[model samples]
Target: MVGAKMSNNLPCGRFEMRISESLQPFIRNGLKGCEKEGLRISREGSISLSPHPVQLGAALTHPNITTDYSEALLELITPALSDGSEMLGFLTNLHRYVCTNIDDELLLSASMPIGDLRSSAIPIARYGSSNIGRMKHIYRQGLSYRYGGCMQVIAGIHFNYSLPESFWLEYQDFTKQPGDPQSFRASAYMGTIRNLQRYGWLIPYLFGSSPAVSKSFVDGRNSAYSNALEKFDETSYYKPFATSLRMSEIGYVNPVQASFRVSFNSLDEYIRDLSKATSIPYLDYERVGTKVGGKYRQLTTNLLQIENEYYTSVRPKQLTRPNERPLRALSNRGIQYIEIRSLDIDVFEPSGISIETTRFLEALSLLCLFHESPAHDIRQYDEVKHNALAVANKGRDPALKLLNKGQEVHLRTWALILCDQLQEICEALDNGNKARPYTQALHKQMEVIRHPELTSSAKMLATMRDQKLSVAELVLQKSREYTSHFQKTPLDNSVKRDFDLQVANSLEQLKRLNNASEIPFDEFLGNYFSKIPEPAKFPGIDRKASQVR
Candidate 1:
């Protein structure tokens, strides 16, 4: 029989043109995760700095990842961006937090108890970091390469450690200025980072890991070395998607540069205290650590060669599937918090992310929560994990089908509607752009998604093909810009002093990292579990009550 045509069947929800009144608090303050600041060097000498994947994760983890922007973000910096120096300064400040404030252990924890393990329980991760479970241990192992061989080097630091809300809000105002280069568009919290001077090494530029280096596991299945987990429109609905780190493999999400903060805990708690979450997926903290061995690093999994007990750790799988005929959409059974995993950090844009884009994400999360999640009869997070990969990497390709509403659906159509839903979210975030940084960024993205000329990944690959620039070169170019920009932002006397102090601190940390030939992994574990050592329960949820249309 001929396959029936898809009707776009976009799921409807109780949504609005503007962010609902209830989510104001969440839009302003619910999620928190992790962020990283790295420098990428490109061959062409054109530099770009990412607003740390960890930071993006951190931003998504918290509902309030969007902070209040100042007219200055709209005013001072947008204009300064033309100068290149100011734009660089602004990004630097944002990167600095990832450099200085991120907790190493939390990041390490993100990957511990590797494989489909972390998903087995409810976890609370610090902003854009990892759950307090085995994931912490896993990341530490990844750091062992050059980071002193001990996970201890990568643990505990809090969100407000260096950059506080006041700092975030300092440049939050961005709309007072009018016009494109002349007028204000939307404000951003990244201004502080963007305008900072003398801060080299604050750029988060690490791209996807090598295919061979990221897996670790006894099961070769977990270590499959293909970027096969993404959905690009393929016939096989449940293709496994995961990378083999040097030691283990955890469940893989699509295209890598995505984010989500989740837990296996109670629905009420997840909902009530989501504002307190701090862990993020897909973000890596910049420690004085290095990736060593012929072993490559995976997306969320970090490593540790500690105490001679090689361990793989990371959050448990979020998606699972039992069958392919019907799409097993979002799950909930006390699956209280919604995972926001579709965002990509736009490198070319200021703030690396934008107010508009974030606002849309904020809206989507709300929509998912307020309305009902669609359903079909499929179970098994492990399978769903593989299905997710099919959706990501193979999404644009033909032959792939996604189950929607108990009926077969083309991945492309689903993706378009998904993007449309995202559009609705962006439009709802902030009618005036004040409260919709996520949405604002999304609207801009909507334009990009539609325009062939602005295809980021495609453009990047094409540039590489045309110019013959190595990925390394493109990364370095990004690094150099951040390096130079930080070299010039004017800092106040106090900040200058603080900056100097931080430099001293960084040097000290670097020294420690350098001196260490090898530290035992056991000690690393000892120190890690000593705090917040209790794991949360996450039994297989029935989720029947949570199903939507």
Candidate 2:
């Protein structure tokens, strides 16, 4: 089926006539099988204030496990895998491993953390005596001062994905482009990223789960959403039509990053903009100061402490060696993968995410890649940002309207059109398999749109309203339920041993890093910042000149 369509006229004839002719077979072969995926799932849970049995130190040294911002918050990561089932299985085992180790703690199943606790009560993650470790801990301290620690505890999942190198090679061969392989691949990935920015609002509409939060989460803050105050009944604060308060202005939204103009046009533009932001000092952050009372408050007083500080819904990424900066890695090598950072943890799934959701996200990414992506100006970028904010706050409202090509369109109408397009991609992905998981997942999203009450956020809100429970109370109840389930169903003895080994090995690795340091901590910090190469001098053919329109 995909083979027949591959021969059809390429949209807008983006490729040369001869190149387009060669692409049919390549597209057909590429669409025939499952693509591999890399996933990183992060979840945060508060330790019981009365019985804090686990130390944050344990999370710092663990490889597969770690804390995000607070000692009470735990994050589990799974290695990249071709099989979604295998990935979920690994995540489950990691959760089980953590559960077994924590004597009297529970991993929160909800996206929002416990709301009753004060910001000062949450401990930042500490990574021993190493300079790098201290840098990480201090970065969190800066985040705490910048955005209150309560907000930092909100958890979510990151899905990292890349088409196989073989796929890119096939694409390059089909297009007959004249550039280095790595540069071509990076440009191709950037095209997909542009499309994602244009149409990413649909994501929160479909999967966003944090419709409400405990009243304490908004306490003393100037909130723009009047629904919270009007709807509050001395327990939960929420908007009736909200999808994810966690993704909205009330959550991780930083005013400082709101106007950041990082471009997706090419690798150089992206690196240049990000590099400039990191080097440019901000008066607000300067007021906070890098150090207070001889203690490091942050790594720097720049608009961004580092490239990772630019909080976007998606990012182009390359894995780095120890002590290597992320932007430096990209400047030297190119994008290895793209990270989807907007997904909220689905409370219904014990693994924080389900295989079905993973499949849908994979399908969405492929759609983004194959679509006709155009270069976007700052106006379009702002439009995309507005759409995402609207969906996060008022997505469930049937009358919600979003900007599409500068025209107002009903949210449901726009979403349904996207879902239909996604179904076509799902068919290509399913290959010849009868049990089409991708198509099923798309259909499920359609159902959620048709009946907004069926969305996860809506369901959570309903439960809270009916039970007269606060967000903290509901999440705590769910946490205990999941913890008990994990306790009863322990991992296989071999799996348990493997995790124990990983824990031991990670500790040893940390010790080695600490002992091997030769440079003074202050000197190491200066050298690291000073050595960040300018983007124009980045090692790659200047592919920006020949970028696709």
Best by lDDT: 2
> In angstroms, how far off is 460's CA in candidate 2?
0.9
TM-score of each: 0.43, 0.87
Give each model's whole-structure lDDT.
0.28, 0.71
Which segments of candidate 2 are over 4 A away from where they belong?
1-61, 220-229, 533-549
lDDT of 2: 0.71
- For model 2, residues 430-483, the per-residue Cα lDDT tens digits are 655799877888899899889999888888888887998777677777777777
Runs with alpha carbons beyond 4 Å of true place in candidate 1:
1-34, 37-91, 94-139, 142-356, 373-384, 398-400, 419-428, 431-440, 451-453, 488-494, 501-549
Model 2 root-mean-square deviation: 6.8
Q: Please estimate how well model 1 matches the true structure, expressed as its whole-model Cα lDDT.
A: 0.28
What is the Cα-based lDDT of residue 121 in candidate 1?
A: 20
